[model samples]
Target: MADFNLSLFDTSPFFLTGIPGLESAHIWISIPFSMFYIISLLGNFTILFVVSKEQTLHKPMYMLLCMLALTDIGLPTSVVPKALCIFWFNLTSITVGGCLTQMFFLYIFSGMQSAILMAMAFDRYVAICNPLRYTTILTNARIAKLALVGLLRALLIVLPMPLLLSRHPFCANRIIPNTYCNHIGITKISCVDTTVNRMYALVAVLVFVGIDLTIIAGSYILIIRALFRISSKQTHQKALNTCTAHIFVMLMFYPPFVFSTLTYRFGQGIAPQIHIMLANFYFVAPPMLNPIIYGVKTKEIRDKVFKYSCRM
Candidate 1:
């Protein structure tokens, strides 16, 4: 229509203005970001390595942990390097195609992480609620299917984003006010109507992440109820103990996500700096903390980590 006639997007580069209000401190900011990246990479890798190599850890729970580790690694990898380039080297010009690519994988990994957490909740539910049927119910084939479905679900849901945005005519203003490219951040610069883009993103979050969180909540509620009915206090304590790591991880994962999403939509009172910082932390905290949470709260991972470390 008139929108397309007025503006057309060329294959030019999109400039990223790293952290809206923190440009003056980008060098200093890169220091902490670098440290987080290293810690997250190392920590998630260690978890993946320990889980894969340790024969004792070859169960449904540990398999799910490995999936979490992979997702943890994936999301950071998608954004951090480009962010570091922007922060440290002042290389902020990313092609439209490249920006969209990062946006796609960033969302995909994030969605998968949420799905993996839901699967982990299911793993715990079966383990605690139906102990005898755990193995029979969650066979290797089923676990594989769950993982595949999670990956595909994320891919399918996020697939329309870049394609939808690509058709839009972008104005001359290509500066994305964040550390890296994001769906809303990128789409906001377009001269054309991005109502579809915004609505789709909202629906995707509500349908995908919303449903995953609801399932996780329902599983935990059932878990708590089952724990309460157990006759033996020791047995109840043990069951609760097993879920502590996952609970810690879930706490670390969901809060920042929810807060960032709220800030993007309804938080007009919040400062741009704070909102941008929260978005950055949403990508950083989960990956960095998940392995540590598992290692500290779960004895087996702790012992295995140390066992491998001592030998090396």
Candidate 2:
């Protein structure tokens, strides 16, 4: 039997399995996955382009939408291309440094998207709860500052992850049985003690997702209570209508995220393939669905999309 704790000093390439327990069907699976990649890229890029060129979109809400589009583009861009290569071309080997780089970008961008969502929630809260003062409250300067703060927060929170993992000696299995270099997935294969990494991972999740979710839920709760106080049905409907896209997009995001996180933290007995599938869904689904939800629900974006489509 091979020793599980044998530490090697040489830097060998880690083999990445595209999706465990379904390696034989990777070619077939890559079809929808390819479509997802195409749609995600095209959709998010179109959102960025449209929001940038249209002067009417230069508002706090759309500014946050642009932030979201960028993060959506980034979150999947960090993982999917390498996954596509693994699925289609059998390119599974990645160096330790390379894997660490991928892990860094993945965590940072994922955290960024969550932060952007919180910002969007705040935007809606201001718009609905304090309608007359919306513009005064969320000025361009404040929006810019919020965006910068979000990026900085994501950086500070996820920065420790790669550093912690890099110092650890990996003497166990070099084969990572998932599409991308996830923090948990990579750390599990390390030979040395990973308790610090695990603890910090929990801390990162709590600080980012846990705290953000609480704030977002609080904002919406206040918005809901304010809505109930208004006597006019037309005003209530109009206010709710404005939030439809954000609400739908949130639905597309958090459930899959919570499911994947739960599976990762607690579902050790779950099949590797299931874990990989949920992770892929968490990465791929939201980016592809976000623009679609906004385009369908928001009249301004929808009309602009149609106008641009006709011109081109």
Candidate 3:
């Protein structure tokens, strides 16, 4: 029994968690989560498909856009399958090794997505604010380098999470009370104390996602400042049009995330359910709404989607 690998994939015996106090909330939660998961899968995939099939979108901005679409697809793909099983099929059992593996991929997509978003913001900043050198600034080599940086940074930062998670020993009552296996919940099951894991989580967040988000914010500020300096109406209009999607996406992407961090870090024990719910939303909402928001707000992606759909 001690040598058993209790992973969901290994032994699909356990259900993730049943409803705590209110059974009705189970239906409410499961229904919406299922809807969100399906939509996100479809939306992100559609964007990727259209962007890939179209020849006109071969430029740097479109390349970055497609990369974002890919990340969004991968982020939820890592989460939703396990979540669906846990939520609906009653298959929640996961081994310590499996949980650590899941967390590694989870962190990879999260970190990679953050890095890609930062790169896209820089692309926009250069395209609109410095068109005189935009071609040279984001040349083919530079774009490839940015993509390499995102993957490498993600690889480097996320490796520690699984390594750290593996070192912890799980106890008998390993029924993690969440729809998916996240670090906070997984760490809670460890017989060994989880201070080190939490510290590692904080460090990874700081170095990868946190710093990238801060840099993204600063990039946008500079962009806005540049917007103010431009005297011509057309330039202002073009800048505003290009940036509006990014600004809204940033607003959607950042504020909930910040509050979510405080909630998960500080409120976990006191309000585990609420914190867990918020953490679930952190992945679901961003990946789900990103394509929709960007497509609706930007004409290019919207037109491309329409064109591809018509052809299909």
What shift in Å separates residue 100 of candidate 3 from its native position after superposition? Answer: 1.4
Indicate the residue-level lDDT of 155 in model 3. Answer: 92
Regions more than 4 Å wrong, model 2: 1-10
Pick the winner on lDDT between candidates 1 and 3: 1
Pairs of residues clashing in candidate 2: none
Can you list the residue pairs that collide in candidate 1? none
The per-prediction CA RMSD against the true structure, in angstroms, equals: 2.4, 3.6, 3.3
- Per-residue lDDT tens digits for candidate 2, residues 1-312, read 244222222378788988998999998888888788789889889988999999989998988998899988998889989999998999999888888889999988988888889999999999989889999999878999998998899899998888777776775578888889988888888887899999999888888878999999999999999999999999999899988888888888877777777788899899979878778867888898998888888889999999999999
- Global fold similarity of model 3 (TM-score): 0.89
- How would you encode candidate 3's per-residue C-alpha lDDT over 196-286 as one tens digit per residue? 8899888877787578888888888889899899999998997888877777767766677667666767764656676667777667787
Q: Write the per-residue lDDT of candidate 1 for residues 1-312, one digit (tens) a residue.
A: 443322225767889888877888999987877888899999999998998898888888888989999999999899999989988888999988888889999989989999999999999999999999999999877998999999899989999888788777787888888878888788789887888899999999888778999999999999998998899999998999899989888888888787788788789798888898778867877789899888998899999999999997
Give all TM-scores, in the order shown: 0.95, 0.95, 0.89
Prediction 1 global C-alpha lDDT: 0.87
* lDDT of all predictions: 0.87, 0.86, 0.74
* Stretches of candidate 3 exceeding 4 Å from the true structure: 1-15, 18-24, 268-270
